[model samples]
Target chain A: MSDPLQSWNDGPVKASIVEFVARVTNRGSSDHVPPAERIAVFDNDGTLWCEQPLQVQVFFALDRMKHLARKDPSLAQRQPFKAFLEHDLKTIASLGKRGAFEFAFMTHAGISEEGFDALAHAWLEEALHPKLGRLFKRCVFQPQIELMNYLRDNGFKTFIVSGGGIDLIRAVSEEAYSIPREQVIGSSLKTRVDTQNGILTLIKLSELGTFDDREVKVENIGLHIGRRPIFAFGNSDGDLAMMRYTLAGPGSRLALLLHHDDAAREFAYDRDFKLSPLSEALDKAASYGVRVVSMKRDWGKVFI
Target chain B: MSDPLQSWNDGPVKASIVEFVARVTNRGSSDHVPPAERIAVFDNDGTLWCEQPLQVQVFFALDRMKHLARKDPSLAQRQPFKAFLEHDLKTIASLGKRGAFEFAFMTHAGISEEGFDALAHAWLEEALHPKLGRLFKRCVFQPQIELMNYLRDNGFKTFIVSGGGIDLIRAVSEEAYSIPREQVIGSSLKTRVDTQNGILTLIKLSELGTFDDREVKVENIGLHIGRRPIFAFGNSDGDLAMMRYTLAGPGSRLALLLHHDDAAREFAYDRDFKLSPLSEALDKAASYGVRVVSMKRDWGKVFI
Candidate 1:
């Protein structure tokens, strides 16, 4: 009862979130929705945490790729793996849209799914942000965590709909955001179940099953969540479709786009990061009916 | 709890289910699973409801295909469509495994995702079982519903993991099983999102994205659930992999295979039903440690 939004600044953004949650939860209010219908989805990466030097997964994959290349020197022959070993950003970027996904399949696949999950969990716990000097999982935004808990306390089922690899995000989601594994939806690999001597194994394949971004985020929401989320938050052009999908739902809906404007507290760049570009959603926020939350103005603190 | 599993008769099958729930839920017990880890999954078709004469979806698809064929007589020129219109069982059977899937894509795809959801919801409500003389949704087993409720009351999150179309199963999951749509993971079609002047739409594609059966079920359990389930139930050989996956987990796991053995109360068959053949799983149940629940022996009543 004491301040669930304690990290949030006393401003219109905080006031608006309080108002929306109140309106949907109050039984006497016309906008009241049943607890079962209150679904809220948030995009990971820039929306929930720091994504400046690189996305957490990109960093994780790079470290893992480097480790794999070290163990088996033959792997460095490939373009992405060679680029990963050399830290050649140019070649990696030149590989275009598939570059990230190709890196994904190479770094993570060909192992038991549970084994990869353990590797991810260990790395997230140990890997420090290059700039933040803190473990990647600890780099999650305090204000957003508060926002999620506040929504959950009001009966919303919070889910992570990310473009990041599902396995990577799931490893850190519970510790970072308190969202459960099942509630996290993201891009995934096609896996086959292998049973040897009655021991079950889910082997992760190199093939990409879903590249969850843009319009495909909406497709995955229908496939995984099977409902139109009443509330959504994101901070990238990649998340515009999801925000639009949330706003298009019938209800007293609320969608917000976070603008990382406080460069002093957090690195700020709308177009600098190729992996998570944000200019379009920021520009179209007003027209799309998504409120913009400025980090400088809306948050009392950034990282927990 | 006033016997939450009252419809289940006094038998070893009922006792084992009760014992498994107690052991997993009791904190002092060596096998105690934390509330969040107590995930249970159930297959749909013959396991949860009557699939005799034909699986519910097949019947519904035939009705819809016939309606479409009647409106456009030229549509009957196609193999499956013509076969559906003619009620040509041999032709449908000859078309083989792809026939059901081909009929699936033909019947459900090309419509707006929400439009299809509404159509499914309407059809499920109005459609009656030929032999049961009741709405298909209402024909759900009372004992299974009781079992689900009992597990849920013990903090287990019950999920429907079936090989049926995700959209088709979702429409009735809430009403029939008290399992929410988001908890239902099944086979799915690829979808594309369209936004025109801020109106968001998801269109179901003709292509199948996943077929959640056998090995694929284990893959999806990893993809969607993000953890191994401790309890699983099914009736077909298609469910053996899921049962193995459940039992192989590091816990006091329980996997039950329902046998449709009471023809007097409900139609009984194992190999007789092509869509839901149950021979291999039933034959190998004891070796795999999956308990077999005979309908005649385990249930006091079949329908709610």
Candidate 2:
């Protein structure tokens, strides 16, 4: 019955996060940061939740492909869709950047804004990962959720900057992370307004827009948030740009990257991971003085 | 020595605006609304500030075009640019929808996020309208500014819903209107991330995104602000969609449209003006029970 946040296993990491947040929030304290400058950004997937086997977005894409394949048999022969149709994880993984981009665009195409939200909500409600056998939402790291709440409680405006689709993350971010829809920035598909039968609808277009990754993440932070973050957390190379951006800011700054090294408690892969590899970023963490949190060394447990 | 807001005209329209704001902000009074429900949105251009001869955005676009034309004369030969180059207001006006769309894209293209904010601030500081000969920031509606503070003092969260560029509005909205940057919603151009040399940059692309007009305003209201506004003010057809959205919310809602009818004090044109015309929307205002304030009959003075 004790508070899970108070007994978080990763005491050192949690304490560092809490202490940094406290210093930033306390105006009277020497480390106090002004309210206008209290910005903290987090990477969603591996840092806050699990992204093993494939990303949540890849799951959404595959699901959409399955649905499309049922309606249009031609999708079964399409490059990425064919791999997805045959359950060829190897082939799909090897499809590389171009194939992945195509899959992402096609799967999310033609969905109405409302329809996409409903679909995301419905999928989260029932869909279970093959490896975890648990709903995607349930797989979220409890400690990270607590950390987000703690930051919010201390007046730090928290945001999720991810490579996932903006609409997809927005659908559940408010409910799951307490991050408002507006505060979530991610890759986006093009959208347009269409009036049909006098009813105006915001329709998802077939064009792909910016992908929130590495350099794009840093650019988006400036574009959308309009301020540099003082604190940033991530778990992969995809987050390197954000970490660099945060560290480059004046005055107090903190960057923490979670290194998955506990195979029993969580999936253990860093440089070898096909998706979201942390190789070069992990190597540079030491030079940048970013705290590289080893899951095995830092945490006494994994989930709540 | 007199207070500008206090010395300004107190006609039926201004009185109504003040009275309605007072009722909503009075916490102990029966008309007091809770902070969660006390939402008020104002149109940016004319309602919150002046938009005569051209909108503030048109000025920014023209300046941007001139700057670009200096660097590349080929740009001056383009459709909108060519019209801009000839200084032919008639031809520019004749180009109409297509011309405006092209101008919006080209004028905003390739500017870095930081550069855009700096440009906006610089222009606002030095640029003066040809006739007004006053800083654009000085042209803001004093009565409305006072009303904004009064509403905030009374617990209402004020927002600026505008048709100007989102970044441009956000740049000056905080200083000019006292509304937070996040509370300002406006038309947005597409942007992407780029890395030049070693520094990361957010570059505005030559793509026209949502115009935040008519129905898109309603859609963006729902997208950006989860809660529906209880009170809204607008001066043109661009705001009809937002007014409709606000009025449809489940509560006591007020929608007011400022009808510019005082030629001496302010430019008066409804159906004739190409920019922000009030033709068809004005006709439907009566059926919707939207309050229409005629500037000539409802106000004693124009600016503070």
Candidate 3:
């Protein structure tokens, strides 16, 4: 068929991405990256889909917390659980990084890995985006999906490196974006394998694992993928470190940040958003030479 | 041109493997596993090569420890260092899991991920297997190499679920087994992203990450691959859990344990290997329905 990224507006952002892929993939070009080294990583929350009101995974976790609380009334008296029960997001946020992680662990842990996978799968299938009026998976950007296909067609191995839970993303990523579970690196909880009644199962534990945010994202890329991605896409400051890491690689590199400047179509807060604040990254894009793709102008259509 | 596993003598072990692969890959067969679910996991140290006297990675780490001691003489008096320096295997062994882990951390950490990659690459390229008298990479089993290629040819994704450090194996696994770095999961040291003097790098920390052996191997398989392997291979009891996990999956599954009963071609030890002891696993193979491939009988040739 025609170029896969044709859904993207005929603009500099699309042009740059196409040109970068062509340059790196050309056999005779000096910028040629071997297929093994052509790793491309994308941030999931805002870059791939809508994460304006709250991250979809967090909402799922909150629902799970309420479900668990119904079984054990004592959970409502606990610190993070109490805050979650009250819908006291400000109080939960005040608890800071450690509190947020503990809350996620309390809600998300204590299940088999497969059980958690099924839970995530069921949630994504049933849950709709409140504002978008569609299933959460359906909120994924059409142009970005096209870009992933375009890159993969050119021999780049595309991966979703998100701040969301790895298990949650792994559930729907393959069906939604053709990105397999192994290629999806993100925050995780500790898991232990148990053979119960001769049945092997991995039980998710109440502990946080490598929090795939900010500097940790770059660290995880090295730990998991073991290769510098030549291409990286993100939408907020949490990805600044990863973008810098990608651009620091010796050969050709492309780093793009999605600017949510389309209030009519999508949410448009940049400097003031608490969850995925884009202030520092937006201000430093010029200094870092990172391409900023505006959601309003760069995409002919947002979602498929 | 011929059947890939030709080095494997025509025996029950060989026949079972071939039949299993054929049944799983056949589209119309009841046991058919789709290409996406055709995951095969292998243990590296003994199953892939020789791990009799010592695991190749442990030897490499010992060498690195001595090298580090040369730089800082104070390390010479440290418990593991003193034991390593004096060739006191008993003292080192007496140090137990925590001590061995500390030794590994001291020797293997404090380098950039790429730097560790280079170190391991250089070691594998230049170092010889003491008794084998061949480059370490060249000591890999010929039949298993053929099996990996054969499985890949049949569209199965083969991975090394090893006890060796992930970075150490990643350096040479691609060339030796054609398994890419990401698919090679193993023990890892904690790492952090560091930007020193404007250069971004992942610095391996002194803390240990997932100690991928025993039940942890199964946990890591679930955590990393997010799929149960349809086929599993191992040579010791450390792999018992992983093999069981693989076999427990639905449809068709194959689990094979390599019995090192060939003292002539290779070392012969099962119950008393100390390091990679094959005691319980070897004894229970029959009851577990795991195929035990005798190295001397099953293979026409050993190393490539």
Please report the candidate that would top lDDT against the real structure. 1
Candidate 3 residue pairs that clash: none
**What do the candidate models score in CA lDDT, each in turn?**
0.85, 0.75, 0.85
Interface DockQ per candidate: 0.81, 0.24, 0.73
- Tens digit of per-residue lDDT, candidate 2, span B258-294: 8888778767778766767787779999887688877
TM-score of chain A of each: 0.95, 0.93, 0.94
Candidate topping TM-score:
1
- Put down candidate 3 lDDT per residue, A1-304, tens digits, no spaces: 5868877989888899888988999999999999999999999999998986767776787778889889999999987788877767676666644356456755776788767878888889888887889999888889988999888988889998988888888998999899988899988888878765567788888888767899989888877888888999999999999999999878789999999999898888777666667889999999998999998999888887
Off by over 4 Å in 3: A72-102, A196-198, B73-79, B86-102, B196-198
Q: At residue B198, what lDDT does model 1 achieve?
A: 52
The best-first sequence of candidates by TM-score reads 1, 3, 2
lDDT of 3 at A301: 89
TM-score of each: 0.96, 0.78, 0.95
Q: Write the per-residue lDDT of candidate 3 for residues B1-304, one digit (tens) a residue.
A: 5778989999899999999999998989999988988999999999997885667776788778889889999988977788877667677666544356456655877798778888888888798877878887888899999999999999999999988888888898889899888889988888888875567888888888778889999878877888889999999999999988888767889999999999999889888766667888988888887889999999999999
As a TM-score, model 2 comes out at 0.78
Interface RMSD of each: 1.0, 3.7, 1.0
Weakest lDDT window of 10 consecutive positions for candidate 1 chain A:
A93-102
Reference-based lDDT, residue B282, model 1: 84
The parts of candidate 1 lying over 4 Å away from their true place are A74-78, A86-98, A196-198, B86-98, B195-198
Model 1 gets an lDDT of: 0.85
